[model samples]
Target: MANREYLKLDRVKGDLIVLEGVEGVAYGEILEITLDNGLKRDGKVVTVDGNRVIAQVFQGTQGISTSNASVKFAGKPLEIALSRDILGRSFNGIGKPYDGAGPIYCEKKYNVNGRPVNPVSREYPRNYLETGISAIDSLMTLIRGQKLPIFSGNGLSHNELAAQIVRQASVKGEDSENFAVVFAAMGVKHDDADFFRKSFEGSGVIQRVVMYVNLADDPVIERITTPRCAMTAAEYLAYEEGMHVLVILTDMTSYAEALREISSSREEVPSRKGYPGYLYSDLATIYERAGMIRGKAGSVTLLPILTMPNDDITHPIPDLSGYITEGQIVLSRDLQQKNIYPPINVLPSLSRLMKDGIGEGFTRDDHDEVASQLFSSYSRVQDVRSLAQIIGEDDLSEIDRKFLAFGVAFEKQFLSQKTDEKRTIEETLDIAWDILGILPPEELERLSPQMMEKYYTQR
Candidate 1:
């Protein structure tokens, strides 16, 4: 294979450049750009139409001239070096070491855009991943190999929740030792990056974690690559090394915005909210990468955190994501206003794989019952509260008043917790029992007779 350098540049649009006289350039092939001033940048071939090749430069085109700049086709796709040593290290979105650890030289290098796992080879996600947060573990349970996203709005505590999950998330059984984390932050602020680093280091889980950060100041092109790079490392860890890898990609909204930016620069037809039409399929490429491979001892579970634009759940980014993922963990602005730390609304949020993962051998025998009863009871609380506003609480029935009280206790005791506090599945279930005890045994209709006999502890 020969590396060919082309000097005939056609056009330059922001970070994208067009080159004619290119032969055999593959889509996603790595390219090297050399400016007239001797500065070099890396780019990837995004499109190839006959002899016309379109490459997106990782570094924006600020000081490059069409007649003077040159491009070299690397004849291969973008790849990241992968090995067991990638653990406990940090890299930029493009997989260059960012934590002062020099370039990683390994025997294996994986394409950043990993090959999708075949549906026939996928194993059912059947194990629990306890995040140590009561609001999630007790209600919307996270399972290994599931793509569960966090739907949040601006100014909510989503970042804190993400950090907490990374800090406290663990496997329940003997396979705990095989757990590792791959965290990717796209278009996040400097302080937010520092917060994640500090949180991970403080929790002492930094050793089992690999981080890829694309800061707000970084080129938008890299934001597009951040999650892919992180997923590549996760695939290496999970499939090759047999470690259960949790990949957390935060602020996917930013990643989508970057995609839209590039689409606009390329003059492509836009879809809903000016996003590209392929948004759904593009996102699926990332989310669908999460799952268990048949006969493989490891799995990849995705916890993508994306903030809704103007808190609109129907926005294209979240709407398309919800369609692809197993379920969503929705944060509440109303609850956040009330000072709830997690602010996870149990009614709207769900874990489709929770049933397959919990009860008996997974977490606890009472987990399913307790979660269902809490949701039912809290839903009634919302109804009673709405009624109280119409006809004052003083005029309401005693049961409605008890429902109101239960709601308050549920949020304070069951939902809200200190940032540093970590609760086991048993503790989360016990808290649910204590909160459900406020209502009469008849009110707990969701629980079975066996569940009631064992876990129901009412006064």
Candidate 2:
């Protein structure tokens, strides 16, 4: 049968065009809506009831009248053309080329809704991916195929941290040659998008970075597809081209908000905080995409950044995300007020997969012990600071005073660094040792005798 064009629409409401008496319409199938003015817009089938269908127009439903618009079903789902050439390009939220470069040569096209990696086919994630940041490399190490989210807050420096990771991230050994980055920015301002492009270009890493940007002024519907387009590109590069891909999605809160808006437009039942009921499973579809497949020579690592609403980690967005991802890197408002760059609060930040990634072969032999000692020693510093607040610091015990000094040095020396500065794993470990040296050798209970003999020095 020929593609039948329905000449009448049942209703038009807030980006949704509903049609009645529609036949053979499958969910997720593409649609072409032509208005009386002869202008056409793209849409996809979102809901299908008996002889009634609801489709979301990618562009807003403005200027579309129910009697004047026509709908034609396209027999395929939304897809983006993929190839090796997309590595250095930039695209809009819906995978259309945003850069001046022409359209990509379509070697193959991939559906944006990617299939989840099979549990049985997934290889245990191993080996560390270095971000060249001391706080992360020494304490919360990001494994190659793990999904580690950065939990930040409004007005913090998460954008700068994300750019720094894009510039300095690398795979160890000869595999470094195959490392690439996929950066997707959703609901960012025009200036923020410019900063990312310029930063990547200035660092001379743009050639290895693929960017998908969705500006704040763009359609909210496009924001919903931005990360999916990014993931499709990353999946192509990693699984098809045999390259290690690091996918960085910034401001996932914007994505979640867009999801909520669309859900409200559909008049769907709301869950916690007025978000859609399927928020957890919706997030899992994206977060669960990162992994290593058995017999495949590549991996996809995800680092999604979301700003907690009012610094409330219990907010539905961050709360559900924490349940899906491997671990989190929580940024601190207190540290940012002190002018720290990354502002990562080490106490709550953790990487559950760090144990298998760091060792004698991956980063360094003392990585595990150094990380443990840093965590243990820092916890004591917090206690000492609390005690000093009640009584005068001058009246504190000798060890307590030393802990105060150690805390100060730890934040300024270890956590704070230039935005452009890059440190190797070796240099990061050395700095950790230097900070640990502030305390008496006998107080270092986390470190083994052998590790202490080589790295520990009393200052």
Candidate 3:
């Protein structure tokens, strides 16, 4: 036990090491292993069963011989340094500085594996966080502590939409100084990373953003740590420093894939689509991290973006994520084909927390009604659209023709928005009423008489 420093690696398989005769090794403890080539590689203990310890080497075991390896446990789990200086900086998945600013000057270090928010201290999310996109702000509203994910497909503009939200998202009427963004991108392509960097910088929000990126070609094990590191930073900023943090993790599908790869490496049994059965609890570790502590001045709101495989929302990644998060914003391939800029299919997308976040004090007084009426009207628009496809539009009744016209205007005006456009909640609500006015007043069943009198106008 005293000579655990020179323990031999009993087995090596694809970035994983199996060693026996290790005493007192704990799970998640960092290890510095010296390879036979005199090169040092970092590893972390993933399992500890009596005297048999399994560890994952961060650097692949390319030139290592299992007979002559030296392992030293760091005596603690993986941790990251935290400071106010973390803002306006970029780092790789392991929290190493990548922005060329050198190492962060800080005295505080935190384990990347964060604990879930305690239920007693949890406050229900009620404050509105405006992203300035009409489709999101006016209908699928994002609250301060809610976890809402955006479900997209290949070649969709989810990246652009995510960038726009990071740029325009804010706590309405609150000063920008109190808000911050922690963006964690998992296994993204180089071009997508560059787009996010340029978009944040160009929008002048880069100063308040802390970005964590894991490129597609990087080590697959690092992908498993990226979001956890980002969430740890968000917790430090929000709970410790009283700064409202918006954490956006893009391409979560890649993360889940990484989990599957590691599970295969460990020879674990596969579940649906070769994913592990614990996928739900694994996702919960990330999604459940978002919330407002009862007495804290700051909150962590999550907006995770995951691309659906081949546009299938029923895929394991999205299916499990939908069960964990508050709600989802589903992007439509049909709308994308139509050349819509932000191609959000509003009918199927929803925010379950929309009710508690909007209304008199949080947003406009008529926000709830306006959003309901818009949802109802737009849903009917779908029915009319399907019917029009069966029986030609010219053969419809006069009122049906008016409904068809309203549907067209709704998609063109209310649903479609520019990438650079920033619409306030009030403006978004007004635009909804304006679009609803295209139909006769009787068609607006969801709107109250008071709202109709205030916003609705006779043709």
Cα deviation of 180, candidate 1, in Å: 0.5
Model 2 TM-score (2 dp) = 0.98
Q: Assess candidate 1 and give its TM-score to the true structure.
A: 0.98
The sequence of per-residue lDDT tens digits that candidate 2 reaches over residues 1-459 is 116899999899888988888888788788898998899999888788878888889887889988988888887788999898888899999899989999988756889989977899999999899999999988999999999999999999999999999999999888889999999999999999999999999999999999999999888878888999999898888898899999999989999999999889878999999999998998898888888999888899999999999999999999999999999999999999999888999999999999999979989999999999989999999999999999989999999999999999999999999999999999999999998889998889999999999888888
Model 3 segments more than 4 A misplaced? 1-3, 36-38
Q: Evaluate all candidate structures by whole-model CA lDDT and list the values in order.
A: 0.91, 0.92, 0.88
The CA lDDT at 104 in model 2 is 89
Predicted candidate 3 versus true structure: per-residue lDDT over 248-358, tens digit per residue: 998899999999998888788999999999999999998899999988888999999999999998999999899988889999999999888789998889999999989
Where does the lowest 10-residue lDDT sum fall in candidate 3? 1-10
Best by lDDT: 2
lDDT of 2 at 367: 95
| Clash pairs, model 3 backbone | none
Higher-TM-score candidate of 1 and 3: 1
- Using all chains and alpha carbons, the TM-scores for the candidates as numbered come to 0.98, 0.98, 0.97
